[model samples]
Target: MTHFDVMRRLTGPLAALMVVALAGCSAGSREGDPIPAPSTSSTAPTPSTVPAVPPAPTVAPTATLPPPPLDPLTPRPSGANTPKVVNVTGTVTAGVESGCLLLEGYLLVNAPTSLVYEGVRVKATLEVRPDLVSTCQQGTPAMITSAQRL
Candidate 1:
């Protein structure tokens, strides 16, 4: 080839190589800013381009309950004091101390004289102190200060 043809060919390939190299260098930088270095900090913040993770869930609240009521006339079975007159309804289970009849039937009655009676069905308005009613169970024998069979 001639000198002019050789020079043209050389210049064309050199210009193309320079353009490719310049394109790669420019890609590493923003419009006017420098490229950032790799982070070394253990807690380095993530780039804003990435999405953030969400937080965990929580539990709801609850309510509480109240206390029970009190009764006065019902005597503790283990105690010595003879119970006052109280009307009860239960089957005749056994005979208790004193003249108590130990009603084993549906209704039970406790008289002031330490007498207890068991009946299949007993309806008696016993003269029981209001304070002792809370301790009485459905079938518990109570001291019947005054009782009238219904």
Candidate 2:
């Protein structure tokens, strides 16, 4: 027989012998053998023997007051129909975004073309409009109600 045929003949017997040897190694308690009890130490208690702890009591949530605004502008009187107008005095500077002007951290909207130039010192009256949509991302959005060069 060729070497390949010889190998094929031995492969089945070799595999069967290996399986039998592995089965013998894995064999544990035989028939009629008494089962061994679980080992225990007196120093440490078993999980089932330990007593359960009582759960913590639940707490009711309390109402909290809202925080005050951070802006320095005067607070509006309670129940006012109009937003509070604020006066800002500072040099008008170009914002990081194009077509945006800032004065004292307030982005100027509807500002006159003359007052929109950079480095122009001006006194401007503004109404803070947090609801207004703006492309000036660097400062708070405020509408320029009035402005004058100083």
Candidate 2, which segments miss by more than 4 Å at Cα?
1-80
- Per-candidate TM equals 0.22, 0.46
Tens digits of per-residue lDDT for model 1, 10-38: 99899999999999777765455576644
Measured with C-alpha atoms, the lDDT of residue 31 in candidate 1 is 59
Candidate that would win on TM-score = 2
TM-score of 2: 0.46
Q: Taking the tens digit of each residue's C-alpha lDDT, what string does model 2 give over 1-150? A: 899999999999999999998996677556665864445656777899899998998988687775554343455568755766899999989999898988999888777886556899998899887656677787888878888898
Q: State the displacement of the C-alpha of residue 89, model 2, in Å, after optimal TM-score superposition.
A: 0.5
